[model samples]
Target: MLKHKCLDQCIACTACTVQCPVTAAAREFAGPKMVGPALERFRLFDQDIEISADYCTNCKNCDITCPSSVPVSLFSTLAKAQYRRQNGKSLRDWILVNGEMFARLASPVASFANITMNNAVVRTMLRAVGIADRPLPKYAEKNFYRQFAELKQQRFPDKVVFFPGCYIGYNDPRVGMDLVAILQASRYEVIVPDVVCCGTPAVANGYLELAEEKARRNLRELRRWAREGWPIVTCCTSCGLTLRQEYCELFRANGADEVASQHYDAGEFLLEMLEQGRLNSEFIPLAGKYLYHAPCHLRAQGIGLPSLELLQSIPGCEVNVADAGCCGIAGSYGFKKDKYDIAMKIGERLFTKIKDSQADMVVTECGTCRIQIEYATGVKAVHPVSLFKQALRFDWVG
Candidate 1:
């Protein structure tokens, strides 16, 4: 984020650079502290930024590791967006950033959409557009919105607005359904209103205006719910970070303060409810050990590993935290043909850890991270909520 005031506070500390996963992976990255804060003074005079802005994946590792709270990733995104504005965005960039719109279009004909999307012609066209040859996830048969409508919740006074970001809305409705079931078990009525992508993909793709526009589209509903004191919980770590962190940094959107203070990751919310003596402790013990990867966005929120803690509490579930670093797919960063190799290289450490752990499955909060893990290591990966759903013996609604 490299705000001017934040840059001014930089003590020339190499802490951020030292902790950056990209810098560790690629020597050309020029590190976070140098490219962000150090370059700001030169950038003010219109000195062409010698460093490649695209080198940054906007993973926020620098932001999280900074001692002075400088938003290193913010500066990267801002610079990239500015660069794109001056130049031009390609069709591939447009498609990746506007994933919300594409998912909606693919929903009704999801089966056919996947086929056409993967056809040889489509792959060639996608490559020409600068998108990767990587296989895209098929849209969920029924989006969570439709599934939420079918949910027959026992009315409760306490309610929460579940923010099912793009992944849950169009790709993994089961996560959302599992989330709703857990909340219902905890006696909280889940109210899922009309919402759009939180725009994490847009930010990563350097489409600031589109990202903010999508944020506005969803904030109208989020703001009203916030005003009424409803907790806005998101399962997707990227979406949670966008709602609680990015909105204020970029647009300073209304209700953001309330939302930031009140929003929770689904795992964190469940743990919080459990701590206050409200969770349904009637979990049927799950068998086998689990390897958990704490998503970078989840860690960015400054909340302790609530999901990991919760998973360990389940009887017969031996949990091992993947101690490895970022799992490369920072939003859609890994899906670009150019960056795909860098993404995989960055994830090598995590993949090795997952493989060595010898767990039956890998669990993480980000949907894209799950995709990356499965691709890199041939092991099944799932959200922590999926394990919770099984442990709680709640039937999958999707």
Candidate 2:
């Protein structure tokens, strides 16, 4: 189905080929334009080779730059599904694809689990499971749901539910905390929802049934919030995109469309607040420069540089946009051992750009991008919510 749709529109024009940052940086790797449609043909004819589908970071650059508006990322994902169906799933695939199960199973004694994960023996185990040499995030001592449950109850002018996704809820609760603080400062009643996985990782690994199950569960939960007139607010770009686009596709044949239409990212929601004059803060002078790496999913949503507008609103802050494209850390793509070298090589251009910028900090909306850029550049990368939360302190309501 991915290939049936007009290959002629491509003209083999190679606009996408040239625009691809990954192809330009990693000479060994074939560009998305070539790989996407080629894999579709590969699925048609020769289905024996278990070619590594993990190489693609799912950066969406090829789709973004394509003149034909070909959904290269979508095509690649579908092709991966076809490939995996023939080759069979790996043990590592089972672990990564069912990441929600691992997280829930580890939740009761998260600290112990965290300790074990950090241990040398466990690190080696993880390496055996295909994770690279990168350090894993420790589980928070207190999860986001528990923390939000304790917040003082206050009725506000507008209400919205927060879906912190699995990563922020368990690993980095501070992102959710800071997001709540910013929303409360803007006079919105933030409702913290009990949400599980968004299943982006599962879909990427070709676990369609598992991904569908997770999507249905999340859709029911989100639909309840929608019925209560609360828009689903998300901090993670991947989660937002999954809820907005992919979930709808999962239910498209079944004719359940409304489940996927109810999500918004913090940046898009903040931009709306700015437009509506609901968010007001005194621009505090914070003398520093920042380089912003826009996440692929965020760009896919068609909201351009709202993060830049928010950052620039901070007085005395100079925001330098990174010309370098995808950070090459597409969720857990860079964390796998086999792909780590290619991921680093693909990200080298972005790394060089950040080094040359001499910026004080790197800012991005996506948590994974923050981690990757920080790992690659050795610069403190923070979420835009943190900066806005800092600025909110200056605007004390009498």
Best by TM-score: 1
Candidate 2 at 149: error in angstroms? 1.6
Q: Candidate 1 lDDT, tens digit per residue, 1-398?
A: 33668879888889988878888887778888877888877776777556477788888888888888778887778778877887888777788888888999999888899899999998998898877778888898888888888777888999999999988999999999888888887778899978888988889878999988887877888888888988999999989999998998888887778778879899998898878878865789889878999988888889989999889888999898898999887877788888888888999999999989899999899999999999889999999988887887544333
lDDT of each: 0.85, 0.75
Give the alpha carbon lDDT tens digit for every residue of 316-374 in model 2: 78888896778887787777787788778777888999999999998888877888888
Q: In model 1, what is the error at residue 5, expressed in angstroms?
A: 1.6
Against the hidden reference, what TM-scores do the models get? 0.96, 0.90
Q: List the residue pairs that clash in candidate 2.
A: none
